[model samples]
Target: MKLLLLRNFVFTILQSGTVVGLIPFLIVEPKLNDMLTQQLKISHYLGMLIFTLGFFMMLICIRSFAIDGKGTLSPADPTKRLVIKGLYKFSRNPMYIGVLTILMGETIFFKSYQLLIYLLLIFIAFNIFIILVEEPRLRRDFGKEYLDYCKKVERWG
Candidate 1:
């Protein structure tokens, strides 16, 4: 419905902003001149490609959440159904992987140890949140169906 889509849009924006938008870049400013002394480098373009893939992966997951699961990324408005399609078929937390991938790309591009540390912190936080919150809620909401999916899929594949 229109209402669900609207809510999804709003929450997606909020989460995306915090996870992959200006916040991280604000924290980790890359020096262009120092990024690579030599002219164009493969790692430079590779970083962009990785970033694009990460963003594309996120879009796919968000679409799956909305169309297939009737949900947003926010815990307050989680998926009504378990999403086990596309990337979900491989990993239970592909959205988080997408986020980490984006961060990884930024770190590689910037060559910033601060960003790398930030990525590690984010990963730890995500893992804790998933273990303490998301997984429990999924078990409560979807019960055996979710457990069965967990059996079939790798947690972080």
Candidate 2:
């Protein structure tokens, strides 16, 4: 149990760094004065609030995967059981939604059109991956139970 938790925690950090940390650096340099590239006039407070909400959403989904699914979110160490509790009840892909939400918040906060484009590209890629890979694997692994859950939950909400 301790080993599992440690593995999950380490993988979670790596995944979060890749998705929520490194990607942003590639998209845009954080700057106090983004006057040259600023495309939106979103309030700073609003951006922070959105970022906080996104972070919380991701945390909840990660916790659900660890506790209820008895697994980590990493593809190499995926859930052992089908998880349909919490945000999963609302969206079959809440984890993706949470990541996209974080990207959206970054877009607003950075006021970077490049970041916005990156976010859209990421969304499209995730949609394709879910449709072509993840969903099929779930159907195969969990069979009728997964199909039923798919019927109940929106892919993204």
Candidate 3:
């Protein structure tokens, strides 16, 4: 129990720190709208539009998929039910994809190298969480059932 709590705490700290670290870079630091080209605002808007569409799809998929399977946002302790419907049918990690898309959108909008790097760090953390914390637990709990699901579903789509 203590180990689980510690792990959860550490995950929380990393996630919170990533956000806090990005806040200054996104809001306080002024970046040229576009360093490479003069059309920074146009690119920003384009990125925002693409991100918004992806985010919206993710939200819809989450509601349609996650709630049915009783999945939790955290990988620390997940529900017993295996979710392989809706977005899960398409992508094993829609929520993470959504989050990463948002981060990428922010990076494009802000044109901040620092925030982009932070976003990459967050992706690394999430990748580790999925590989180390989530998948093993699922394999342990679900066994052949999960293996079958894995056979059908791709990790990301």
Query: What is candidate 2's CA lDDT for residue 49?
Result: 76
| Candidate 1 local distance difference test against the native | 0.86
TM-score of each: 0.90, 0.89, 0.70
The regions of model 2 sitting more than 4 angstroms off are 30-42
lDDT of 3 by residue, 17-105 (tens): 34644463455355443453555578679768866865665565445434565544455545547877767878778767877777777
Task: Please say which candidate is ahead in TM-score: 1 or 3.
Answer: 1
Q: What is the C-alpha local distance difference test score of each model? A: 0.86, 0.83, 0.66
Model 1 stretches astray by more than 4 angstroms: 30-40
Clashing pairs in 1: none
lDDT by residue (1-157, candidate 1, tens digit) is 7887788788878987677777676776456455547565677678778888888898889888999999987898999999999999999999999989988888777767888898899999999999999999999999999999999998898
Residue pairs with backbone atoms closer than 3 Å in model 3 (clashes): none
Report per-prediction Cα RMSD to one decimal.
2.2, 2.9, 6.5
**Steric overlap count per candidate:** 0, 0, 0
| Model 3 poorest ten-residue lDDT run | 16-25
Residues 44-127, model 2: lDDT tens digits? 557667778888888898888889998888888989999999999999988888888888888877777887898899899999
